[model samples]
Target: MDTALIVGYLASICSVTSFIPQVWKIFKTGDTAAISAKMYALTVTGFALWTAFGVMRVEWPIILTNAICFCLSGLILIKKITRRAR
Candidate 1:
């Protein structure tokens, strides 16, 4: 395996896992007042664009990272929105 590819996977794993705590906190406390809707929207948009870039470039690392990132981020966004609504 390529060293860079290995590094990419490791980094992606770290970043993707980073969102778990936030998700848990949001779920446990049900307080999303501090979560910025604009930020989440812009971030998800950026992540989607980057995923597209990865597809065009045939870069698995970028694609994988963004996929996981997007999903986790999306979850957070939804949790925040729903939590606040309730």
Candidate 2:
């Protein structure tokens, strides 16, 4: 792959991996109290939009990154809702 493609892949990986901190915190501490439902809600919304945009633009890197990000963020959102209910 070219340098530009490599950079795109790295960028995608970093963006998707950005969810690791939140995921680790939730799993290790089992504490979702500090997390805001609204924020995650909005984040998931934005990720969905970005994913759609990536698809429309035929940008595989962006699509892949957003797909992983959406899943990770969705997991946290679900955890937040479940923990809050308990």
Candidate 3:
């Protein structure tokens, strides 16, 4: 296998897994007090755009990574928004 491919896969894994701890923390403690909804909203939007761009370009890595990020960030953003409403 190519080193570049290995690096790409590693990066993708890192990017995708980075959200796990935050999600787990939120799930276990239900605390989003310090999380910024606006930041996450932008993050979700950026990931959504990146996913779309990846789809248009037929890039699996970008699509998969950003799609996962989009969903994870969207989850956080939703929690933040809903928490603010309460």
Give the whole-model CA lDDT for all candidates, comma-separated: 0.85, 0.90, 0.89
Task: Return the candidate ranking by lDDT, descending.
Answer: 2, 3, 1
Q: After best superposition, candidate 1 residue 33: deviation in angstroms?
A: 1.4
Candidate 3 clash pair list: none
Q: Candidate 1 vs. truth: CA RMSD?
A: 1.4
Regions more than 4 Å wrong, model 1: none
Tell me each candidate's TM-score: 0.87, 0.89, 0.92
Cα lDDT tens digits, model 2, 45-68, are 999999999999998888999988
Candidate 2, which segments miss by more than 4 Å at Cα? none
| Candidate 3 wrongly placed segments (more than 4 Å) | none
Of 1 and 2, the candidate ranking higher by lDDT: 2
Residue-wise C-alpha lDDT for candidate 1, range 1-86, written one tens digit per residue: 99999998898888888888887887788778888988998888888998899999998989988987888788878877777677
Candidate 2 Cα RMSD after full superposition onto the native fold (Å): 1.3
